[model samples]
Target: MQSSIIIADDHPLILKGLNDFLLEKKYNVLASAVNGKDALELIETHKPEIAILDIQMPYYTGLEIAEKCKALNYQTKIVLITFEKDEAIYKQAKSLGVYGYVLKEFALTEIEQCIDTVSKDIPYFSPELLSYLEVESTPKELETLTPTEKEVLKHIAQNKTAKEIGDLMFISNRTVEKHKSHIIKKLNLAPIQNSLLIWAKENQTLLE
Candidate 1:
């Protein structure tokens, strides 16, 4: 059976491209919208079997739209397509009950596979993201972190810079750097700053 779908994106080219791509794949495009608000209205009216959403949109975010869909009990499976592959975004998408996530840089074949997989009530994620998840799921020792180290991690997740974290925690810049190094070693995470930030954000909910 052909899956009925609605796509929501702010870009005209993307909206049209997606519609064309899905049409070629034999899926029915019930509607397309430029923002989350319109997407919600279309879903409520049309109730397509799936919704393909872009994360960064004006007015309301894709996550916000997904929440609304779930609340209304719309039955449409949501697939979030975005450029961001950050762990925090992935975690949020999971929490929102998204059926699939396709990175924008991946081939159209990947997107098609995701749509087909999710239409069958299964979840899908890009292979690169799957690898990241495998690394993140490994057990780590919390006892290795001092209280100050954990505090620094929490502040980092809240989008604080190293200097900001030092000021807020009433520690010296050197102390903050030492704590960050300890955190990286304990977590077995990559040495990059962005990777650390993503890890911190992804794990923040659990820390709370």
Candidate 2:
């Protein structure tokens, strides 16, 4: 059976284009809304199988609407369209049970795949977004290291021995080892042999 869908976006061109595309794909598009208010009303009234919402809509953003729908126990599956590649928004979407997250730039190319996946009771996120998140996560984890720990890590990345690092930093070997232990703990690396050295080598470019 054709999936019942409602799409909304503040941009007229995007809204029309998406509606037409879904129609061409033979899906039953019940309504289109220019704002989140109308979108939520359409969703509440039509109870579509999927609601494709723009994340930055007026009155209520997509995440806000998703939260409302969840509170109301609505069964409509949400597919959020956005230009944002932000981690906080993505995490909020996941928390609100959004079924699909498509980047606005890739909306036309990716929407069908998102719908297909969501229809099968699976969540879908843009592959590009996932890659961005993975890259972002590494920097965040690296941020946990103190300045001295990071300096120690950078030296380790250059294949520096503990004594060499201690000499370069004007610290003792014991202090260098202590910093190494702290770095490993902050990075949550295993206490196995050379794990800290291996991690530093692998992420050398990030250190620079």
Per-model clash counts, in order, read 0, 0
lDDT values, one for every candidate: 0.81, 0.90
User: Who wins the TM-score comparison?
Assistant: 2
Error of model 2, residue 57, in angstroms: 0.9
Off by over 4 Å in 1: 133-208
User: Candidate 2 overall Cα lDDT vs. reference?
Assistant: 0.90
Worst lDDT 10-window in candidate 2: 132-141
Residue 201 of model 1, lDDT score: 73
Writing each residue's lDDT as its tens digit, candidate 2 over 1-208 gives: 8789999999999999999998998988999999999999999899999999999989998899999999999999999999999999998998899999999899989999999878877788897897677676664568998889999999999999999999999999999999999888888665668979877876777888
State TM-scores per candidate: 0.64, 0.67
Per-residue lDDT of candidate 1, residues 1-208 (tens digit): 7788889999899888888988888888888999988988888899888888899888878889888888887798988888886888888898888888888777376888988778777677787675666456633455577777878888988999889988898988998888888888887664554867877776676455
Give Cα distance to truth, residue 172, candidate 2, Å: 48
